[model samples]
Target: MTLLAIPAPAGWDLDLAHDYDDDLPPAGAEAPEQDVVAPDPAGLAAVGLDERTALLDAYVRGELGRVLHVAPGSIDVAGRTMNSLGVGSINGLELQARMEAALGIDVDLQRLLRANSAAELIDCLAGQLGPEDSPHKSAARRSTGTPAAAA
Candidate 1:
């Protein structure tokens, strides 16, 4: 077998033994101070039933609009069921995955299938979620229209 030699590009160095110590900060140098940002309490606390239901309602409506390629306001989440909306099993599964990912929770597929309407599905999801299921907290807090700390 014949071997071929390749030439290095202009200004490219092939050396691998250079000392890196000169590039590092002095041993006694202190690290720069960084601002510590706190996580939003609203995002970290488990949401109450009503708030979870509302969040789910909004999320479901948005997802339905995205999957069906319709306006979110036109979806009528509270008034219609998936079956009535012509959402097939595949679309239902897609919706389920989206909900699970958005809420950071796992949903039972069988229960999801059993939910006839968007409202029913939201109820089912809310029922399944425990206090520890997610970080978002009560609907009352969200409905007040101000952060708890600010209030």
Candidate 2:
């Protein structure tokens, strides 16, 4: 076999990989127009646990969006399963790391991977955010857009 000599310099295309070959829209179809909704910083300023948990929910959605490389509004996270959303071990780790650092909590990577839906994952992280905040309470607040019934 003959060896090829290297040139003095090589050109590289070091751009963020935007060529989503598997994700191309069908011909004669227009991509949906939507904007990723971001959480309000003011929500984080609230002293109540529900408000903070809700903020965490929104933040998890944004971070999950970044990991999945899709708009947060593009998916009904509450309705869709994580497997359908293409979440896997590696991306789960990526999402977990971002949430952990941003929320200042420890989330088991397995806890995240085992979640069946986006809301489930949100609940896990929200639970970690506070000792008294149960995952069910977080899920209820997220799903109904209202506080859980007080005991």
Candidate 3:
């Protein structure tokens, strides 16, 4: 699971054009594409997720779509590094917007752009908006599995 939250970069949405497919090509088959699977709300709620969690899930899915080259549906949490390595610079602006949307609060995009990783972005969000300061932030951290100390 990426540390970055929702409303991923520009063109990220298009990455989800294809759904995750079981017939993933072999590692060398072709250039991969990313897909964004919708979150399972019921499952999230069962795990104590809030609306921010759902929003963050969407944002993460969108980021996966934006950054990966594998078929959209083929993305898994384990593939994040591989995906980042395959793409050019991540769209920080896009991700920032998505994160803000997920949190349902405004974020300093300029501050977020400085982060280098998805996890870093989560940390930035947490630092920028204290956990107790925003319910969305609290929920997002729980759902994304971000550590309080790191935040």
RMSD of each: 16.9, 14.2, 18.5
lDDT of 1: 0.59
Candidate 3 off by > 4 Å: 1-64, 67-90, 126-151
Off by over 4 Å in 1: 1-45, 133-151
Candidate 2 lDDT score at position 107? 61
Question: TM-score of each candidate?
Answer: 0.52, 0.53, 0.34
Model 2 pairs whose backbones collide:
none
**Number of clashes recorded per candidate:** 8, 0, 15
Runs with alpha carbons beyond 4 Å of true place in candidate 2: 1-46, 131-151
lDDT of each: 0.59, 0.59, 0.45
Q: How accurate is candidate 2 locally (lDDT)?
A: 0.59
Error of 3 at 132 (Å): 3.1
Better TM-score candidate (1, 3): 1
Q: Which has the higher TM-score value, candidate number 2 or candidate number 3? A: 2
lDDT of 1 by residue, 28-144 (tens): 985443222322234434666787667666666777777666666687666666777867788778766765555545555555565567787766555544254444322223344
Top-down lDDT ranking? 2, 1, 3
